[model samples]
Target: MAAVGNRLGDATSPYLLQHADNPVDWQPWDDRALALAREQNKPILLSIGYSACHWCHVMAHESFEDRDIARLMNERFINIKVDREERPDLDRIYQTAHQLLTRRPGGWPLTLVLTPEDQTPVFAGTYFPPRPRGGMPGFADILRQVDEAIREQPGAVAEQNAALRHALGKLSRAPDEGGASALGNGPLRTCRDALAASFDTVHGGFGAAPKFPHPGGIERLLRHYALTLTTDDEPDRDALHMACYSLRRMALGGLYDQVGGGFARYSVDEYWMIPHFEKMLYDNALLLGLYADAWHATGDGLYRRIVRETAAWTMAEMQHSRGGYFASLDADSEGEEGRYYLWTPDEIRGLLDDDEWALVEHRFALDEPANFEGRWHLHVQASFSESAKRLGRPRDQVVALWESARDKLYRAREQRVRPGRDDKVLTAWNGLMIAAMARAGRLLDEPTWVGSAEQALDFVTERLVDSEGRLHASWRGGRAAHQGCLEDYAFLLEGVLECLQSYWSDSRLRFAVGLADTLLARFQDEDSGGFWMTADDHEPLIQRPRPLADDSLPSGNAVALRALQRLGHLLGETRYLEAAERGLQAASGALARMPEAHASLLTALEEHLYPPEIVVIRGNMEATASWRARALKYYTPNRLVFTLPPAARPPGLLAERVAEEGAPVAWVCHGSTCRPPARTLDALDEVLDQSGGSS
Candidate 1:
């Protein structure tokens, strides 16, 4: 019943809508806001954050909501709010500016004061409170000082802005490392060595405290391990160990939501004991693949459990009725961070009988001091056998008791005020989850999970993609908006390819081909090789950002490279292959400088060094299913599999291939060279193994 207070009321982004009632007069990033700032000759206050970001909410409540601070912001600067998820291009550009200005990483809610003329940042910081605190200047004080400096010392401000522009421009340009010919395994070796050096021997993962699940890095490690295999015991075994160790610690620690399923955004502590607790679709998607690979490597029941549970959580919480998965789950619930997940000793006692409570207390380290602000975050510390030995009870009994306790606790937690969900269906993230679901379905033999992936893919293709075959970035409330970025097309292409392998469909294959064409037409950097983050027709920002570095998620260019390589080989399209090669060349310098940092790019580089084996299983669906299953039995990190009827089209790679025997047959090829058809599952296994798991 309350009236919305600002221009954010008309915005599509949920993050922008969250500020609809703020007295700050927030405008969504648009031409009107820029024009107003230019006309008024005032600095622009650009704040970028996502809907589910906790600090974003804190800043909104502390500074933007206060009328006094709002007045200061309104009079001096034209204020704009951006949902980082909605406009990753803008976020990437400004975050880079913030780093350039402050010599540190930028995070939400990113605050910047930019010139109205060119929108180059003059000042940048993150999360300034209403009152001076955390060694940061108060929002009002900072605003006043910035305004005074701009007015009193216009020449100095202009000089600083000019310097920033020059610096940013230099940073934006890709480095000239060598030529495209420099592409090889040299960078991959450098990266592997760096990871080995930084790897935490005592704990899992690399680096020090505040460990994040770098799924891309783990994936790279897995591939490196596969590539460098020399019997069971070797020095190269370290790669597999590092990846497995990190995943093990994470699964056992608070990062993995024990009561529910899925992973939090990251751990706040080194041991993965305390998490930030926001669940993101991208994180789970990446981790799912890693875990599935881990299971394939070790045949560990724990890894399998993780893969199943994470997929289950995604399906239950993230998937929308329309089929596309939601963006994220907020870290906060009921005005408190981790409130939905944390528990008290008394609360546990109330839910369980004395024996059950006691067992759980010891098993989850609840009897130890409270880990999260005087409340317990349930994290499994002891194995059932260990707890049973200590308690003088049978292991099975302990397991039964713990399961019962967990169910009751999960049920009770469900009744509490749940964290807010950002229901916007992101095309890139859905692509990620779709890939995860499809892979898990095939690898773990879960048809329902594969079906779930197909359904989500159907939703994205129908809703997010326009009739002209162009893809949109997001969808919500039966409407799609925002032109698709490089990631949207690239990631979805990967997903569509995965679905094709899971259950071959003619329409999805056509969709994949269309997406590949669009990626070339819209996002490709014609002169310089890698793809741009935005489309050629996209609204221009301060810079045309072409980010090649890997972050929490893989780089867009890296993903684009992999997608192109796979699709090219699958379809026998030389254009896609050439584009992929160009992409690798473009990223060559950056990869050479910091191969460890460019895990995904290193992966694409590996593919160039040793092209993936392409296996086309052509026959009746019923007969070919066994052959397809056998092809995936071994862990082939750099391999592409497609199971289609004898008559599937595009007439590219599958042109001459057909069913030979009464049973299904597989045509195995390395690059353009084809091998004789393998008629039996045993014959296919021998072919794959002879190539040392992958070509």
Candidate 2:
């Protein structure tokens, strides 16, 4: 085959590189591409999608690879390709533009036609076939029509540009009076009511089919339960129940890999039995922390098991050798979805002995009809307790048999062709995973996990972050490209903070402060009181989007707010606090209207309303370790723990506090007010009790 590459041959993003061989003259999202569009007076056809997106691959094959469609695109437009993961800021702007233009939710392989004059989007949509199908016009036809319209109806395009600008202005501006003085518990109540209304009683999770794991909402529920648990309120208990039930169902369902470990992108069914089967690093990372927290809250062994398995799976499969995590695993294997994961009853039977098959069949609902395209997506149909009782065997025996069967199955499945892995390391997603590993490792006493997190953080610092203390969005094949967005700083700052708790260092603390500074300088909307998705120096788009609503992942603005607040508390920086206040104020309106949708921001608000108690333990490493163990015994979300060694001279909150020469001394402090140092573990408990730390 002759080289048909245009500009994507040198791209770092695997998604863009995948289209390098396409006949279409694809260019990266850059100043050069935008300038070319303006110079040539051609419409900019921006196609945004990620590596793992199924429809993205379909469109690439059907249209981009087609010589006829490619010719039309190359001739009529300054074609640009974007990996959404690497440029979420661009994705957010265009996706919102698409929503405004079409009045429909925008998704992957987003096809947008923008005017060259202002780079204003005149038309937008998702995937379109090469030829007409399902009542939608063909990609080629759309391109031709858009080109003709741009040339012939310049006035109409100008009108759209003006209208879109107006809408964008309205959306970005802060409300008068900034928001309610105090949002209070009204928003919390609204969120609770909404979750209750949408809650699936039988199968768990919210809404209907094609369910996504709303980890942020689930965390809110858990926090809500913690807040009102002692009140003996029905709402509080119900919130906890819903969260627990949903988590339990997801863990047991096919969304969670039964044979292997880690979760799929989402389940395509309401029952959580059939997943789309793509494994993403971000999904598993968030779920790891969620399950770890659940275990801490309820002491559920199942949640513990899930945390262990998921973390293990992440390390085994998703993690890169050097340290950072990979982006995602594709949904298809050998051109068939779920081929790597699905198994038939006969296959299971052939793999297992008679006794093992009997237990496995009953446990996994093999007796029922196949639910996943004539194949069984293994889900726990019966609980272990029930299985033990039904099989007339001891619970321990049943567990042993199940473990044996799963090990054999996993080994056998490993021999099959695996799904394609998107090996690009994304800073934001890695930060999330790092936070998960750090927090879980600290709480669960898994040093290895903590080491993994540290290594990844180190990798990011050395490779992803450039000199002048700026972060890059993606790293692949020793090449780092694209300036970091708000998410990159916010999430990495979060990871640094979390990792600091597990194991502290002066360099890491400095790095955190640098990120916080960069966040404020680059992304903060100084006037509106919220952070913009893109930086001040980012490529000029139609609008600077400051989206607050939590999407598939938590909103970057929300994360920034929370991260800033946490940093403020840790470092005693009034600037961080002020910035966080502004962010909260900016978000107050959306939170007031539909708090359920702004779950991540609500979390930030919760921390703001009730400041976390700061516990600092100072002494020799051995003594402080003992004190740390005592403090971590109970599950306390509203507490920050720091075990400082004598050699360490901490700054900010712990700057004043010094190590007393003797056994470790624990000081339970809230802001500047601190009680006398507690010399013993018992004394520390007493101090904590008086300070309302135990509650």
Candidate 3:
């Protein structure tokens, strides 16, 4: 360790700023941190995590705040603390290394030991205790042992580093061993078979333990099922059914906050039992979109309820003072994960009458402890009718009583110590939220959600985006920094497009198209078929990251492709279409090795291709909500509905539509020519179905 002070004080990331006053000499991910260790021939100790990470905060307080640990760290290592959100490339490399090293899935507050000179990791693990208490060796002990290993057994450390690097280099542990003919029918079937093998029949989602929602997993399978169902419906529906099952499980599971309405970051157990507790804006936005689509497909009240409730939460908790959305809410409070969500039986019983309490307890199976300690996690059952029948109470009365209790408890709970609210508005996240709000507004037919979309859009446009029309990543108070990356560009573009569809505004369409052009020019990977994370003008990090992989959210390229596709359709620009097609093709080539990986990107591809229809509305569209009902009457997935604004010269459109004398109507367009504008929603429906088969 070098000293008590570090370069992290000068860092811009909120997570890094939290540690600016720490006793540990924490340096940001910069050359100075690496060069110092190389100069002193000391091993590098790298800790990577995010602001919302609970264990990251725990380890920081227990060990990094201690002077002795700081001294040990300075003496033996070039210590670096990286905010994972800011530097996802570093997070990805090390997380992959961790999973490979431990034969387990990786997560935040990741710890790793690396060679000082070559930037190669030698040893790694997650958070360790300050004094060897939590069934793990202390951080101080690990530091000493790692230092000794480097000093006494230098060869071993070097060998481990070499091996780690080699393994990371060979991305495919076993390449294309599936024996499927490249780019043919065999690959698709093979991929589908692999999907089925991992598919959970009872619970849904793929994989065994620590399952994720995996949006791309559902999107691709849904598309595959749709395409196959067109000609043959034998096993294609399996994928769709599997996706529904998993989605439903997630909706009902503790992964979703019953009270707050948004989902937690992840479930720790195999059963989606306990959550990591942080409420990320991005996760809710994605899930809302997923649930909305599910509602579209199934017409299920449960899915619709999830979408509405989630939108409500986003509007209430995640919305920023400036109108844009916040990044996340921390999972931990009082040094415990899920402290805010858990309650005791006494706490619950105090709020409810004896009969109501019994009914509620029986419904949610709240007799015993659900949380780690003796507290109960209020995961309510699917319905209270059964419990009402069991308790012989009126179903309506049972529902009313439960709602009253929820309101009372929620009010009381608000007075307690709340989790840290990261109110910094992020452009990428805001974009996703905007999309969800706008789309949900349309689906639910609520003007309030649309109002939220408008307010958020105004916030981004007024505060985050500059006069030059370029966007900044985040904003707080009067301060905003970090140049907007490709993700922000793609996501915001998607947001604006959704907004355009919501209001059917030509002005938003023009703005989105203009921004998309700018994004293409600035971030488009010239040689390859993707976009760089940052602009070409920005300073490069140690690694020049051109991310093709999707984790948690869709990769920038995937988002860009979808954005471009939507923009092209709106503007009638072949350039945008061509670029989008190229991106889609490139992404398709890399899908197999990472199926559940790029859910966002896969969702985009699924949206752009297959079972799609084009509905073109001409003339007055407001008769009998003629235009609105035409768009809203039927819930069709992936249909591009173009309401031709009253303009003779369509800005980017290649086609010409002639409206009759006065009546507003819709033209359901297929491959080339547009059908005559339909006077009623029924006529439009028939035309759309004739063009594209119904779900």
Candidate 4:
């Protein structure tokens, strides 16, 4: 094929574009590259990674850009660069092979080798430095030995390739129908312990160095904590208390953008003090939902205000032309790290009068020698109560003054040149945003946010999910491309479900359930227990990882299983529940063996084993304005509540129990059965007390 240099320059993928000038001739995943490898009898050197991956950037700059390395790659291998985001299928397949061949785990900047005739990888690894470093092999050494082995022992190479391929084949097998596959809730205790041990008691996340904010993991903990505490029959965290502790801690940490009011992708340290600097839309969306819940649980207006400000920033900055949210804002701008976000002490002082500046500085702990290496990265000084106590004023007055200060500083910061925004509108990420906004509106009682969510949802339904109910994965500059994977389906379903609950819109729930069915039919890996990350019809990836567990975001299968369980409960269908159960069975083995490794997957299992309470209110969602309003009054992340018009019947799942009787009513269903309808606000409250999913 055309070497790595020629091939990569022609592709438009941002990740691929990031490598366009690499010395290595990096061809995109196109026919010419593969064909040339076969014709020349050279091994295919496949490299896979994404733009936001810091390590990926490092490897690209080190080996891929080195002329000597490029010469070796040119002389010895057929190189191809693939963007993991645009081609997750390819990344999945090879990542699986990388794990099997190396007898180790796989991650980005995946480097692999395969027979020159075709691209079946025989050897694989993550990053390889030019020189041996950190107990790792040098790229040149790996290249020389691997190439020599292939040339000198062709038969042996073929044998190893066969062995790896066979191993991968089994790793991707469907779940057991015989129910022999072993996994369950009993051992979930180990998973919980693992999480507890790793939890940064000081910070609000798991692990130490290179810590990522496991938003999903934290939520799962909150769900459990909320349940256990309220029941009081057992001793553990119930969902509400957990929802409170974890969210409050995170919001107070440096992981949050204390000044601009959004969350960074993660904190580099366990203390949540140092960040890698990129602010992602999905992270913000998920955090927004968390903050909204925090407000509901504690009636903390501060939490509600943070949610409101975050929503404002999201719409003001991240919203795409079609109403979809953009993926991320890069960590760097003007070749300076966090330049757009960080401010000098003098800059802060310049914006306010001497007294105001002193007050602001004292409140935020800002000093002459900046907290973040001479450039201040905004963060909170103390709890509002503590600050109020210190200020000798009422809490509300203190809060009001803090807001005034933040507003003044925000206006000043807005004038600076902003960071580069990756304007790619990914469906899954956008879906998270839409759902977050909608849920915030419902949970914290914000009508303005409800309007924002409606507009964004309208845009997604119109632009991404076409008339035929098919979903597209990404939209950029008016062009939507690629077939959507499971994440797109799962996250969008989340958005629709949130909208349905917020407004009691039958059209929204009806469509959400309809699309859920479509997802079941299209993305479900029937052979396995749950869903595939990518749809079955998409082109094969380099590696096909059968979603083993969750990561930064919730797994598609996890969300899907939850969706099925909720939809089935609302519609009162055993089929949906049955599908969910089957999915649990399929996922049981790994989840039990190492549930901590897959916290999100464990969450799905939790859902199937113990589904949430589904509260369906019929009549004008406006009629039960009091009851529907009551549902919105408290924060209940684990509860699924939706409103349907009296004239509009819910699916068989929810319709069987709730009255379509042309009057205002609220029906609470749990453990797959419904409590009688509630005709008044007090009646609804009583029903909630008796049968509601509230922990």
Candidate 5:
């Protein structure tokens, strides 16, 4: 065979483009590449990863860049490179297959060899080295062996592929036991109990070292606390403590960017003193809402500050000029992990005055041993009051000095070589960020944040949708590619609904309706319930996944179900309500087995069990504003408050809720029932009290 030249130069994904110049011939995953493998009778060598992945870069430099390894791969196999972010459908299927094959969890850079005839993965592993080390096989040797085995013993490969396919098919289908009765509070309680068991009392997060934020689990704790706040349950108080303490620790730790105002991927240590150093848009977006809600729940100044700073960082760094948010910042810069974020003691001291240095050294424990690679990654070691007392200065004076030091260090860090950023705008990720911005904006009374959300929504609707109104999953360099998956539709719908609460727009509501309708038509499984990750029209892969478990992102089916429920209530649409119920029935079996793993689905179930209260306020702008503000004073996850001026005409259930020109009137509804219109502020308060609005 002739040498295959790299063909990834035209790919839209930044991860794919990163390998365009590698010594290995990297073909983007497409029909042509798969066809070539089939024609040449070679097994497909599929390497899956994203641009921000640290190990992906390492593997690329170690094996893919080596001429000898490249020759072996090119001669033996048809190599295909896929950006997991761009093709999560493929990643999900293969990652699951990897687990079934290896009996171990999967991570990137995910390596696999698949039979060319049906694209069935026969072998799987992650991050193989060029030379054998750490008891792992070398990539070149693995390639030679796999190629020889496929040619010498084709029957063995076929048998394993058949078994793997059977296992994957079983995993893809929801269990038949799901029903209305299966959706119970047992799973909810089980999830809470599981979290309690795993909760680290000394530190803040669940489990031990290599701690992820687990925003979904933290959110479940918050909502659980809110639900049981009025009850006499002591566990509710403990739930609040766990959620708030975790937020506080995360904010004050190295996992959060002390200089830049965003969160790293995860903590590499239990103390939260070292992080993986990748700043992902989704992590920051999800954390923004959590911190904002924590502020609303406790009126904590720390939570508020974290929200403000993280939001500032997002808009300044992650958001594209076109309004969509980018994917993530790389973990490495200049070929070293965390090099861009790490700092030397001399660097910090030189940038600050003596008093400011003293305050910084005391507050961040710069006086102690270095944490990451013999250098500092700032984390709060002491409170402002402690630093003030230790320095014998006023608390306010110490805060001012610390602020000055941070600003100076931040400016100095800005001058350093920065981490590479993946600039592709993904619809699903942007949706998460949009919800965060809009929710925080409404809760914190920041109009700019709401405006940012609106702008992003506009970008998605205008740029990411095709002429026929189908949504695209990704956009970059003036091109939108790939049919939108379930998450793109579901998450963006969620964002649209959130934006309506922050600042209502008739067009946005229409967009949300269109999205919901498309989801029903294209993604929903009419027979089994829930939704497939890929659309009905998407190209066939090994398996069509209907994932219910929450991973780095929430489950698409769960988000879709939740969004449908909210929209159904808002519009009084029976179709959406019925669909949501069906989705719950579909996920019931999974919920019963391990509810802690499916926090998002449990959230949807919570709303199903206790239907959300919908409050519609109509009057002059000034009057409605006051009423809306009062209604949202408390953190009510199960309550939605929408305010409209008298001139505004809302659709569906809201159209019936009308007000006179000057009088401020409110209608409060729980599930299918609505209270009589309240003519005055006092009457509105009375109705809310009756409905347990604050609860």
Candidate 6:
């Protein structure tokens, strides 16, 4: 039999590298490992997790790092470790299989024992301890049980594997009957109603404890409110309140870094008082745009402050000097979760004067019981006005003192051991951030943020795309690896479109066109409808997922459909539009069944039902810039505003909308129809106000 040592030493993924020194003979999910497993007639032990996963780290220390456990793992099975971020394809397949077998939702550190020949999962679990605890089987016990099953009950194992394969196959196939003709507002309304029902009236956000930001759902609510605002319905107003309230609560909670600027993954409690602590690029990216839109909708200064601080934190800490954004920040620092972020009353008091300390104590609830392990993780327990009233100080004075105290605390926090950052630049995540930065920059009038987006776009185009124009999923330490997935193409296409709106670039337009073409050619499910998560030429896996529901990030299929619809309309390409409609048809059944779960797709469906309004401004560069800025003042979810210089030659439908005279002229098109060109800012405003409350 072929010998296997720890083969993850040469892996590009930081998550994989973290396990390189483990005693377990951990192999990266590769053909060689699979071949070895088959040859040895042993089941494949597949373990999947990402760098920021605290449980993944716990499993590694408790079991993978133990010599006796490693010995058992090496002797009984061919162990494969996958960084879920680096190989979401594998992660998705196994995670789904886990759910099917266990009848429970799957999570990180997913443990599965697969059939050697076909790689079908026969056993599934997650986060096994060193010894059995809390009714969970020990890692060693599970490993032995799996080995024994394969050896002594081969027929039963094979029977179960066959059933799982059939189940997975069923999941991959979309409903045959639903099509564009069946698509309607039922799902859209259902989604809004569901969100409203689950929304915590007092605390904000949806559901109970362990609250995720669910930015997609929040954005759905915002768009729904905008769409229905003209009807003057109380539910529409309530939708707006839900979105704004959730945004406010999250910004003020421990989920946000009180000392820093970025957000943690999610709040552990209903009140948003404690968080899981890992900071993800995708979460921030999605939330950035949400806050910007919220600011536009309500003109809330708090939303604007969140946008500024979060954007600053992203550029300062998460971005690579080469321009691409990094993947995530680990939940742990100094071997404990939330350690780097937590502090005592003494720490705050030492950093500020008596007045500042008093204000800080009340503002962040430092005087109250410790929220996390007897060390306070700052969350807004009282507003400035309330603190001002209680302390007999002016509100303005309280605010100023709080700011000073915050800066001091932040500076002091910087001196501590920081959480490890996963520095790999992922194309899909970078795409999300690019779109966020571009849109937020334009909305907030931050030119530097726009520049940052452009720089990141340039880096991805230069470093991640191959000679044949295919995108690499990830890049780090001068190497780009792994075939780009649907999200990589779809998200980047959306990003490119956003960048063009922020600052028109001819090369970027070409790039966007190429991405759209690639999606149609390489990723689209022509026979079924929605795009596959992997390209047609991707490495064969147990199953090819066509995901339409939003998870931590928005669904790739939904993003692809949205991007396609937008690009199709902008470029006047019927092919892209048709594909998007087909995708909506494919996802129609799923959307109807669980609309809230498919919030991202609900937005796409809304656009499909009511095509987005596209505004093209052409004239002298300086004059057109003013018109473009004016048009963007409102949060129009179903609008795309583009400005072009007189000398510029735009492609596709935009090519026909030429610059007239030396003055600015705006042409607004809804669906296939165009309104008369508006000559002045007043005329433009009148035209827009007539269009009113989004689509």
Please write out the lDDT profile of model 2 over residues 259-353, one tens digit for every residue: 99999998888999889888999999999999998898889999999999999998999888999999999988888788999899998899998
The alpha-carbon lDDT assigned to residue 403 of candidate 3 equals 71
Model 4 TM-score (2 dp): 0.88
Q: Against the hidden reference, what TM-scores do the models get? A: 0.96, 0.97, 0.87, 0.88, 0.98, 0.98
The local lDDT score (0 to 100) that residue 88 gets in candidate 2 is 90
Clashes of 3: 7
lDDT tens per residue, model 3, 1-695: 32536777666677888888887778887767778888888888999987888888988888888989988887778889987766555777778788877888777679998888887777789978898785878788888887788789878877877777777766522223342113223334555677788888876777877766776667666656655655464637677788677778888778887766889887776666667788888888888887887776668877888898898888888887558888888988887888988888778789777776777678668876566577777665647678778777788887777777667777777877888877778888889889988888877788799889988988988888787888888777677766788888898999997787676666666668767987779877665455666777765443345556677887877788877876676556778877776665555656555544555565455545541455666665455355655566554555665555555345645245556664566766443346766776677667766754344
| lDDT string, candidate 4, 270-340, tens digits | 66666878788888988898777667666886688779879988988888655778777777666566777
Model 6 RMSD vs true structure: 1.5
Least accurate 10 contiguous residues by lDDT in model 2: 227-236
Better of 3 and 6 by lDDT: 6
Where does candidate 4 stray beyond 4 Å? 1-12, 21-24, 58-75, 99-108, 114-118, 122-149, 174-190, 229-243, 368-374, 385-398, 466-468, 504-507, 541-543, 646-662, 692-695
| Residue 9 Cα positional deviation in candidate 5, in Å, after optimal superposition | 0.6
Question: Model 6 over residues 341-390: C-alpha lDDT tens digits?
Answer: 99999877887999988888888877788989989998998988899998
Ranking by TM-score: 5, 6, 2, 1, 4, 3
Q: Which stretches of candidate 2 lie over 4 Å from their true place?
A: 1-5, 178-180, 230-235, 691-695
Q: By lDDT, who's the top model here?
A: 6
Clash tally for model 2: 0
- Quickly count the clashes in candidate 6: 0
* Candidate number that wins on lDDT, 3 or 5: 5
Deviation from truth (RMSD, Å), model 2: 2.1
- The sequence of per-residue lDDT tens digits that candidate 1 reaches over residues 386-494 is 9999899998899889879978988999999999999999999999989989998889999989989998998998898788988888888877878888889888988
- The window of 10 residues in a row where model 5 has the poorest summed lDDT is 174-183
Q: How close is candidate 6 to the true structure, as a TM-score?
A: 0.98
